[model samples]
Target: MNTNDLKIFEAVAAHGSFTKAAEATFTVQSNVTARIKSLEEEFGVELFTRTSRKVALTTAGETLMQYCKKINHLIDEAKYDIKNAGQIIGQLKIGCIETTMALKAPEIINYFAENYPDVDLEFRSAMRSTLISEVLNFKLDAAFVSAPVSQPELDQIHIRDEQLVIVSSAQTAKISEVLNKQPVKIIVFDQGCIFRARLESWLSAKGIIKYKSIVLNSLEGIINFVEAGLGITILPAEVMEHYYAGRKLIAFPLNKELGTMTTVLIYRKDVPPSRALQVFADMHKVQG
Candidate 1:
């Protein structure tokens, strides 16, 4: 019944931990527990299924979360209208693949930060697979990903092309030159990474299915591995040039099929776009 109760409920749902939710909301754990108990009594329904380690939303809580987001969004907009003259002032959570950070995200983020000083902007780096699901689940406001997503529930915009290149240490043989005789050593992100899948597909099509694989999380890590002659990796040409051009690495064009990737901006189509989202789209449109 109380607005504070809703805030506490939302925090608990987001964190799945009463202690963590309490810390987030600047309250003691017992207070959080009491507020949640009061909320359950007021609503006449149990909101969460509790366990020793964590809590999960019950069906009623699941239903309520959608309404909670809407209510909070409306409240944020009303506050913005009254105090900030309808300027962007609420939270915007945008995600992007790691490569976008090197190419487009910095510029867009800088522009948005300068233009809308009151907005709370969160930039999360995520794999496309994870980013898509997060966007669909309303965990992310929008995401920049590799284009042509298959989800019917989402909408996308073609942003730009990322020119991918194979970077190998100068001492290593060219990919085509080495593949027939031996498997080309490759550095890749993780299994679900779209770029990793693309590289694997390209290698498979070359009849070179086997390669020594090295896993790394960051682009810098990949570059370092490739520069040490450990393996070759495919990354944005611009990124490689800007960051590792001084290093002892050679860049070769990828097979046309795998060389150029279209960067796409994706968001849920089912929900009306928020003003912050609208401004994000506009910023990209104007710059891109």
Candidate 2:
């Protein structure tokens, strides 16, 4: 009936489990149950069905949930509109890819924090896929993700375009030479990585698929290995150009489609961000 109850209902619907919703909402399980009960009593319909292990929504619950989501989004928009009418102040949880941490994230965070000290900010580094899912589920206020991600449940704003380039040790002058070697040692992030996927696809298409690759879980590890002359790797030209020591690496462009990528700001399509987030987003919005 009220906003708090609606928030609880939204969280429960998102996670499909009361306990999980409670944890995400930073409340107790009893509180989540009570809010759901109140909503059910007011609407005269059950919103969830619980069995031994899992919980799901019935037809009535599904219908009510759709309306609940709309109502919740409307309330959020109204709040954002009012708060942006003046100085912004609140907490915002932001997500980013590990590659964006060094310069992009720190600059943005520092700029916002210094100007709006009253607003609290939290940062996280995650894979692009995970960041997208978290934003859609409302677990994150917004995120910086590798761009051109097409998802119906999210809104994306293109921030910057990044060109893909091959990075090799300072001692290695040519990539073709490495490819001809016995199982060319390559370092990369795992399967879920956009850069890694693109690199593999490009290599396969180019008839250069006989190389061995090491799959690292972190960007730092990948760069370190490449820096140590262990192998070669690929990354965003903008990011790599800014952070990497030029003396330790040489970067080359990929041919066409595999050559360029974009970084974007992403958030839930239907949910508006808080005032503090809006200010930051507005500042970073790409100019025409």
- TM-score of every candidate: 0.74, 0.77
Q: What digit string (tens of lDDT, one per residue) describes model 1 on residues 1-288?
A: 777888999999999999999999999999999998987888899999999999999999988887787677567656666775666767789998888877776776687788887777888898888999898777889999987799998988878887888778887555666565465788999888877888788788777777877999998888888889787788888887777778989888887778989888888776677778888877667756
| Model 2 weakest lDDT span, ten residues long | 279-288
- Residues 33-86 of candidate 2 have per-residue lDDT tens digits of 999998889888888898877678878887876667667656775876676667
TM-score of 2: 0.77
**Candidate 2 — number of clashing residue pairs?**
0
lDDT score for residue 99 of model 2:
82
How high is the lDDT of residue 136 in model 2? 67
* Highest TM-score model number: 2
Best-fitting candidate, scored by lDDT:
1
Cα displacement (Å) at residue 254, model 1: 2.2
